[model samples]
Target: MAEEQLVTFGLGTEEFGVDIMLVQEIIRIPPITRVPKAPDYVEGVINLRGNVIPVVSLRTRFGMERVEESDLSRIIVLQVQNKVFGIRVDAVTEVLRLDTESIEPPPPVALGMDSHFIRGVGKIGERLLILLNLDNIMGGEINHESA
Candidate 1:
């Protein structure tokens, strides 16, 4: 049997996963040039090898209280909507595989927020894997009124 591809990461205690193929690379949070009218969740933009890439703070995007970026914080650069953006995470765990049979839908209440961001949940050993939907992760929740 072949193992499934799962890129694991975390925020405080909650763990998340994304398809490894979509992930470009992981780097420590770097200086971001703030955009004047960008959405609040859009942290700003960073220059990667001279190519400007927009960045998003998962903390801000998730409706959670923003925490200080510590030593372990990382920017998981992903290619979404034909654009490259870095999604901040506490720390990246490891890439593993879980069969489709192991994935499940999120429960009714994920703290009152929409559960659409979660792609699927995979029970791995003792921890539940919160697979993230990169497509809808930073796309749908954007507030134009506040921008």
Candidate 2:
């Protein structure tokens, strides 16, 4: 089987990536219809064409500093198993292919932060990106009260 490239986006200065197969589309941040009693990590649901899809802020989920929404903000729709969710990224970057040998084990700090969510780390040029296990990252409950 051919190895697939990973698609990544920026959250602040940090870059986060996921398997290309999981991403359905990337769009500009839109007005999200807030869902009552939903988790804080979930920005809320948006009408993607006619379907209602939940949007999540990866920054909030990973305990990163907040960012103001701008043109750069983008929604990366992903299919985590059967459920499809939209991830709010600071910005979407280019797609890059890395041979399997280029991926390394995630560091202890990244692993400790819900270790299961991090699949591995990939070095592209001089920059390093953490590849996320979307299934694990989106599996937990999100606290809406904090949102």
Candidate 3:
């Protein structure tokens, strides 16, 4: 059976994962420079090895309550459609490979989150992983025009 690798992370009490291939790197939360007119979810930009990469708060983007940064907080650098950006997440859990057949379509009720953002639900033993569609999550919001 075919298997796919995933980079899993936590947001509040929930766990989320994205395609490992799209992840550029993972770093500890870094200092951010706020952009005057950026959207609420946009936490501004950070200089990564001289490149100004925009950063977004996943909590705010998902309409969740913002919490103070903790030791576990991390910034997941991702490349979507050739655009590089970082997303602040509570904590990165682990990298795991799941069988493709174990993934099912998103359920009919997605707890009010836009179903389009969810790529699939992966079953790993007794654990259920919410696989996010990175394209849909960052594509519409992080295009150059919006930056």
Best by lDDT: 3
- Model 2 residue runs over 4 Å out of place are 141-147
Give model 1 RMSD, 1 decimal. 4.5
The C-alpha local distance difference test score for the whole of candidate 3 amounts to: 0.89
Count backbone overlaps in model 2: 2
The TM-score-based order of candidates, best leading, equals 3, 2, 1
Over 2-104, each residue of candidate 1 has an lDDT whose tens digit, in order, gives 4569789998778889998889999998999999989898999999999898889888888888998889899999986566889999899999988878887
Quantify all predictions' global Cα lDDT against the true fold. Answer: 0.84, 0.82, 0.89
- After TM-score superposition, the amount by which residue 89's alpha carbon in candidate 2 deviates from its true location, in angstroms, is 0.3
The TM-score of candidate 2 is 0.89
C-alpha lDDT (0 to 100) for residue 48 of candidate 3: 99
Candidate 1 regions with alpha-carbon error over 4 angstroms: 1-3, 140-147
By summed lDDT, which 10 consecutive residues of candidate 2 come out lowest? 138-147
Give the candidate number with the greatest TM-score.
Answer: 3
